[model samples]
Target: MDELKIPNVVCKIEVYAAVNPSEDPDKVRLAVSHVILETDYQYKEGSIKATSNQLNSLVKIQETIKKHRTNKIYRRQMRFNTKGDTTWFYLNKQAAFVDVIAACEEAEESAMGPIKVILHSKDLDKVVDWLAPEMTE
Candidate 1:
């Protein structure tokens, strides 16, 4: 009989609502926060490599956000370049972080829903560790 050994690894997750409360706070803030934190911890302990596309996507998002804020008065509603509000970042094949910015925006539109979220980290393991303490046992 052969004995099987299980690999030891821990996953951590953190959920955050990316909406700015000042814009239009909503009740979904707590829900969205929990989701982001939970997801963050779940994928924290994985081996994933940051890809150029993911990095580029993050940069573009940030730039767009900056532009949006800069010309705030011109646009009545916040708009994202992506078709929907959801944007995701991948580390190799696995997603390191998922930004729910659109979700947050939608939440706001619905009278305080959830704001969008951004997940990012070079070391997935570390992120999980950071989030672990915040979760309920």
Candidate 2:
């Protein structure tokens, strides 16, 4: 008999500055704060970045995009220059972290743009399982 092992999923959280530079600084700061708090992503003046392999952090990233109304890119498809096994999904942005985790438990497809999740399609199931283990109600 053979045993299967789940390999670690590597995903990156890439946040591009979608807002116009002329946009209100306070709003932008507030928006960026949510991202920073949730993902602990370092903020850049124009566009910022971060990466995480942790499931909870990833869930936090998605929820931030969904909840931040000033987040212009929320629920929009990621503008990846290319696509392959990797599917960059944006959470339509929130319900609850657990709810999103639960949805990931079932659906292969995710909402478009913000809450940007860049991952390989091959890794989707593995990533979801890693994020949310099956639970009994």
Candidate 3:
């Protein structure tokens, strides 16, 4: 698989279980959960989920929270794109985030369609905010 450099200031990423109907109409949907952020700081090990929309917003949010690191140092919850057909996870470490993104990119390049990531983030509050509404059963 080819490794691509992560664009600096990515701040947040939202992975979606994307389905290419042209490649395989029968396999039109998959859960692409695992969006994350890349920070210079360290965090506990865990998991969380989020949406592409929320993930995209973090780039701006990061600017706001950059000076308030102490208050913003945890993972956020998972959310579905308002489109709601896909899922995502957010992260803060490039090394850890790369493994999954690389694999997915490879799969797509090789025409393997969509895939899912099951890892969680280290920040509990963020996880709760993302998953709470759906997990309330």
Candidate 4:
């Protein structure tokens, strides 16, 4: 198997998830933690937020895409959402809570709510390539 290469690009990743009144903040926090491992988070009324500057922070996402064979899906979404130096995508919060990285094509796809992930980098194309490279059959 070919080894996955981590991009050398410098970037900032910001993740956000809203806590519905009926939802537990702790569970929401868990979902975020499972997705973006080992990062300090900020709790606000009805929301959870975290940020990281390291590419390794995306290791979970990279591994999940490879494991689930969803690289094409992610690549398409990331490219579609790209805006200049930044791009954003949504993940199913419920799947995240279970430590599964499931991407949401739309916010409504995630029943409870979706975790919004925003990525900013000088070379976003390179970042996207690293995260979801074209895989061969």
User: Predictions ranked by TM-score, top down?
Assistant: 4, 2, 1, 3
Q: RMSD, model 4, all Cα superposed?
A: 1.0
Q: Candidate 2: where are CA atoms >4 Å away?
A: 1-8, 24-26, 32-45, 61-82, 91-115, 120-122, 128-137
**C-alpha lDDT values of all predictions:** 0.28, 0.40, 0.30, 0.91
Stretches of candidate 1 exceeding 4 Å from the true structure: 1-53, 70-106, 110-115, 122-137
- Tens-digit lDDT track for model 4 on 58-104? 89998898888899889989989988999989999999999889999
TM-scores for every candidate against the unseen true structure:
0.21, 0.40, 0.20, 0.96
* Top candidate when judged by TM-score against the true structure: 4
lDDT string for model 3 (43-93, tens) is 112212333323333333333333333222222223331222323333222
> Candidate 4, 12: how far from true, in Å?
0.1
- CA lDDT, candidate 4, residue 87: 95
lDDT of 2 by residue, 1-137 (tens): 12223346665545332334554444433444444235545455544344554444555544443344322332223323226555454332233222332122212242322334455535655554433323223
Higher-lDDT candidate of 2 and 4: 4
> In model 3, which runs have C-alpha deviations exceeding 4 angstroms?
1-10, 22-30, 34-108, 114-137
Query: What lDDT, from 0 to 1, does candidate 2 have?
Result: 0.40
* Clash pairs, model 2 backbone: 66-93, 75-112, 76-112, 76-113, 77-113
- Point out the higher-scoring one by TM-score: 1 or 4: 4
Residue 103 accuracy (lDDT) in model 1: 21
Q: Each candidate's root-mean-square deviation in Å? A: 17.8, 9.9, 16.0, 1.0
